[model samples]
Target: MATYEEVKDIPNHPEKYLVDVRNASELKETGVLPSSINIPLPDLERALNMPDDLFTKAYGRDKPAIDAVLIFSCKAGGRAARAANLASTLGFVNAKAYKGSWTEWEEKQSQNI
Candidate 1:
């Protein structure tokens, strides 16, 4: 699992991917993490399977390498953990879930203010 601090520092490492597994509507209701990309849980498998050029065209970012560092997060974390598991099964070597997810992120952001 990724720590809150690790998720918060994504901007410093361009090679790492911080993916928010929430749906578009959910993201609209609650803003996403700073550097996260949205590939809703339902569509994740297809997106990951797409060819590199197609993946980039669809998501506007390069497809992650098999050994890329992927950090997943969702509403309260369940989906995020599942996402990590799915990625692992698909041969991704360094997938992780942010256990606290957006709920913790929101709570922690409030604490900082």
Candidate 2:
């Protein structure tokens, strides 16, 4: 699993992609993580498989390379885990799920704990 600190350091690591598997509506309800790009779980596979230009246009970021670091996060942790697994199966050598996800992130950010 990806740690909260690792996810938080995304800005310093352009090579890593912080992917939020939550749907658009969820992101609207709960603020998205900084530097994260939403690819809703359902569209993840297609997005990953699509051409680089298409992926870039759709996500405003280049699609991650086969061996790039893919950190997945969701409302809690379930979907994130699934996302990481899917990415790994599709040849992403460094895919990982943030077990704490948004819940832990929100808690930590809110209380500054």
Candidate 3:
């Protein structure tokens, strides 16, 4: 588990994994990480096919494996942490929870249009 603030600086994987569990309305009301891809928890059971190029470019292919460090974040971290844990049970070795989530993001002075 990693605090939301901590992951801000760490680079993602070549095929970076960012799962935003917030609902459509919450997503509209609140913003997301600049490079994050939304994968609502309910929909996680389905296949995941994010744009390879986009993820690769944002997160270098040098260090963490493609499937490692799957960052999970939601409204306030509760749901996200659960999701991350579940992902781990399903074989995602590097699943992590961003505890600070959107509520914290909004609180940050850096978050703005």
Judging by TM-score against the true structure, name the best candidate.
Answer: 1
Q: Which ten residues in a row have the lowest lDDT in candidate 3?
A: 57-66
Q: Candidate 1, clashing residue pairs?
A: none
| Distance from true location, Cα of 10 in model 1, Å | 0.4
lDDT per residue, candidate 3, 64-104, as tens digits? Answer: 34367778889889999988877877777888888988777
| Top candidate (lDDT) | 1
Task: List pairs with backbone clashes in candidate 2.
Answer: none
lDDT of each: 0.96, 0.95, 0.68
Per-residue C-alpha lDDT of model 2 across residues 35-77, encoded as one tens digit per residue: 9999999999999999999999999989899989999999999
Off by over 4 Å in 2: none
- Per-residue C-alpha lDDT of model 1 across residues 1-113, encoded as one tens digit per residue: 89999999999999999999999999999998998999999999999999999999988899999999999999999999999999999999999999999999999999999
- Residue 26's C-alpha lDDT in candidate 3? 84
> TM-score, each model?
0.98, 0.97, 0.71
Error of 3 at 64 (Å): 11
Which pairs clash (backbone N, Cα, C closer than 3 Å) in model 3?
none
On the 0 to 100 scale, the lDDT of residue 46 in model 2 is 98
Count steric clashes of candidate 2.
0
